[model samples]
Target: RNDHMLSDWFRKNQEVRIYLGYAPEPNWWSVADLVHVFTGKIDGISPSFRNSMTCKIIGRDYSAPLIDTSFTVAYAARTSSQIAKMLAGKYGLKLNITDTSEIIERDMYQNRKEWEVLQALADLEGFICHVDKDKTFHFGPRQESDEEVEAELYYRSRLKSNCQVDFEDTAIDVYNQITVRHYRKKQVIEGSAKNDALIEQIGQVKERVIYNSKAKTNAQAKEMAQKLLPEFSRYVVTGKAMNMAGNPNLFCEKKVAVKGCGRFDGNYYVERFEHTLNSSGFITNLDLTNLRPDTAQQYRQDLYTKDSAILGSGNKLGSGTI
Candidate 1:
């Protein structure tokens, strides 16, 4: 009978609520703000013998419902920045994208969520997409700088409870040969790009092939391959570290440097970042990836670029991997 009663009680208290105050006070704000709802399952419950129940929580984005919409559109010769504006119009969102001269020849987004479509389009140009605190959509190139506060890595005293370092050297997917086949100008055009250094190091015959119809010509396919080859020709570095600073604004797709650790000390891009805020404090867990190799990050300024012929630029527009 006691076990049954306890189970009933546990189920009742699992209801979700927004807490504003700490214990011994009028916690769990009686008048909750639905606009700023923190939606998550009640993970745990503990009573401190004072009729006060402490709730363990997981943070969730409440704005997810906004971007979940179906749409279809055909775009031509539109830069990433322009596409961002068109998508953001549905939600009256202000679009802020990195300045780019790269232009898409043609793109068709079938019936899909605006969020998913935006991300897919951005990936074609090696950009990241996310909404910021101001509710602005940031669809920009991966800002690969160590100076930005959002991109800087804190070491020694800044790391909180847990820190982990990992690396994968035997990346079989890292390919040196790329063959892109497409139909153009009333005929089939084929182009290939190869990483000479990777071929020399691994062997001459390690080939990986792909078919891309996005590029209008054989030269465009070759250019696309050149931009992509460097990104795949490397072992991926990933790790998770806690940020004691509690920067609530931190989101995924930002870069950070991992210093003090030998070999692991390099610039890494955050693929996933989860920020948890509670009565204790804010804790951040990061899934990081080193897009560029150690030496490449320092000296390779023009990593990828748009063809001058397409954009009418005398020089190549800066480019990088998605």
Candidate 2:
């Protein structure tokens, strides 16, 4: 009869292949025994049958299995039954009462320690509710409602008070639930406006000149001065001279006062025309007319030579006499 039942299950070649790979042990007891043992049915079996059962039953009056290997067949059967049940539920398939009974029996015969752990986890419920209503499962008020101002505080208190729960695990559970509910909505609404405004404001700010003014050493100061000189050149003597002397004119056409030149004199002095012109502005002539004849001629020659060389190199002389 068992062989006929097996043959009926494997009418198709594919089914036969599957069955060949999954051949049940000949020595194995029927699913009834597994289900009975799984559901605390050790006493239902005769003394001889119980002794022969692969799993070593242990513990006081309750014969819990000491060896895990004995429950292997039972565990596999129970898991397979659970999977079938889940598939049936998902697809709206009709499940037989006999199949359900077999599953229950198998589960009862499984290892007690593992079964206890599975039951504990199955019974557990996290405090926080997911934001997505469809995904959320609500239990009785564990601590507080989501709308309550002090809900988090209350929930945290309950979690800490639960001796069986670890603080980190509880916190993680609560956080995951809350985030799933609120994070997406908050990002779509509040974040959108803030992000748009920030980008728009940045676009409105004008890009103008930038200055760094903490220049300290002489080299740094010189670089800063060079940069500033062009902007302020219109208000300075160098710019005035450059404006007066156009092309190749080696001297200023009009008289301009040089400030901060002397320790004593505050007035401008009249002098003959002798200055060098270049792109960097103007180099004024040093007064040598009042000096001794030989010394004055030597000084004038030296000035001419230096100014010629500077002009030939296409350098701009600043508004200062040598």
lDDT of 1 at 42: 40
Please provide TM-scores, in order, for all candidate models, with all chains considered together: 0.53, 0.12
Give RMSD to native, each candidate: 11.9, 44.9
Q: Candidate 2: where is the Cα deviation over 4 Å?
A: 1-63, 66-322
Q: Flag regions of model 1 displaced more than 4 Å.
A: 1-67, 72-84, 97-107, 125-127, 139-173, 178-191, 196-224, 243-245, 278-281, 292-322
**Model 2: colliding residue pairs:** 35-105, 35-106, 37-109, 38-108, 38-109, 39-108, 58-64, 131-181, 280-316
Clash list (residue pairs), candidate 1: 126-322, 304-319
lDDT of each: 0.51, 0.23
Given candidate 2, what's the lDDT at residue 275? 39
Q: Per-residue lDDT for 309 in model 2? A: 29
Count backbone clashes in candidate 1. 2
> What is the C-alpha lDDT profile of model 2 across 258-308, one tens digit per residue?
322222112211122333434455333422111111111112222222323
